[model samples]
Target: MILFGRLRMLLLRTIAYLVDSFILFILVIAGFQCFLLILGLHPFIGRHLYSITGNELHLWLFFSVTIPVYMYYVTMFNTRAQATLGMRAVRLQIQTPGRMGLGKAMLRASVMLIPWEATHVAMCYPKPIWIDNQLQSPLFYTALGLTALYWLLPLLNLNEKSAHDWITGTNVIQWQVPTSKKP
Candidate 1:
């Protein structure tokens, strides 16, 4: 396999993430519709999503709509391809020291939720582990500051492994052609 350095890997990761985000957007929409239909709340999907302000159940509702997204990523990572659709598009694959064990893959999936979901605070309002609580300014800024640092930590590392990567013991690398032929 071809290992990519920090800059190249980050560029590729961003592209792959954008592509995956689009896929996720579609999944989220479809899943939301399905969820609405199942709950007889189809008519409320549009407004409810945007106006989730004071609803206590909105937290669980959001997770219900989001679980399939995590499933897609987890399943793709564990598959023989070992890459999501976006990763495949960019000619990248995830690698571990050896063939990734099932447990590692599962843990990687769970750990991935950290940075992926939480890092957006730098660019937007804070989202967090305990979002049920109202976001006071101090807490919001604190989370945003921490998230900014979390996102930047990979840049400080030569290996390009982000916080989740370090926790999960995985790397994103370029795909290698089985045989090189140049005459």
Candidate 2:
């Protein structure tokens, strides 16, 4: 029963994450398209659209997607809702004994992004992983281990708390909306 309950929470959390990711993905793509459209509208600058490359493109992605996603999580977690749009949709919220302040929220958000950033860094390596017939980068393995640990922590713990929650001393609980019956 306990295992089943934990699994259910895991499923909910996964769904919430997917929902939030979809929201961000759409926003990022739309923003990128809008930028392209604006450039296309300018006769002089339109010709230079194809010139965006290398570090410039990377910088755009970092600013447009990474920063916004991090800020979104940090702000939402610290807000009165104590949940992202996805978390709220699934009736889940993060809580701590005391109010979750900005510093703690930022910490939690940063920890949550570790696996993603690690994986990206590993993939961005100039050399292939099988160089010299050996696993060239340990970073890929580290990222995989982190991803597995983050997913499995909730199941292993009685409280169903993930790595971020444990590190930040926070809890992701199924929120129950209080109902007021009119007398």
Candidate 3:
């Protein structure tokens, strides 16, 4: 019964994360479009798109998307609400041993993204992992395994804590709304 409840929580968390990611995707696209508009290059995207070199694209992606996403997690975790927009929607909040500060929130956010970074590194290698319908790169396999383990950590533990939560000493729990009595 306890295991089933934990699994349900995991599913809710996953749903919340997907919602957050979708929101971020839309926001990023809208922001980029506005940027191009401000630069007077919105109408020239088809022609000027190829002018952005691979390194430049990487830098833009890291600065414009990755950093903001990381900061979003940190900021939300440290807020009075103690939850991201999606987390709030799902009635979930981050609970810490102490009042979560900037440093702790940042650490939690960074640890959460490690698996993604590992996968990015694996894909950026010279040789592709998928060759002739088979995955041939050790690095890619390691990254894939780590990503699975990272998400599956909650299922392996009684506390229902993921790897990032354990590393940062935080937990995701159902949020309780305070009720006030009218005088």
Which candidate gets the maximum lDDT versus the true structure?
A: 2
- Over 4 Å off in model 3, which ranges? 37-57, 127-135, 181-183
Which digits, one per residue and each the tens of the lDDT, describe model 1 over residues 19-101? 99888877776666676778986645555443434243334444654466778778888888788899999998887776776
Model 2 residue pairs with clashes: none
Tell me each candidate's TM-score: 0.70, 0.79, 0.80
Q: Indicate the worst ten consecutive residues by lDDT in candidate 2.
A: 126-135
Cα-based lDDT for every prediction: 0.66, 0.79, 0.78
Ranking according to TM-score, highest score first: 3, 2, 1
Model 1 residue 129 CA deviation (Å) reads: 15
* C-alpha-based local distance difference test score of model 2: 0.79
Give the CA lDDT, 0 to 100, for residue 109 in model 3: 90
- Clash number by candidate, in order: 0, 0, 0
**Whose TM-score is higher: candidate 2's or candidate 3's?**
3
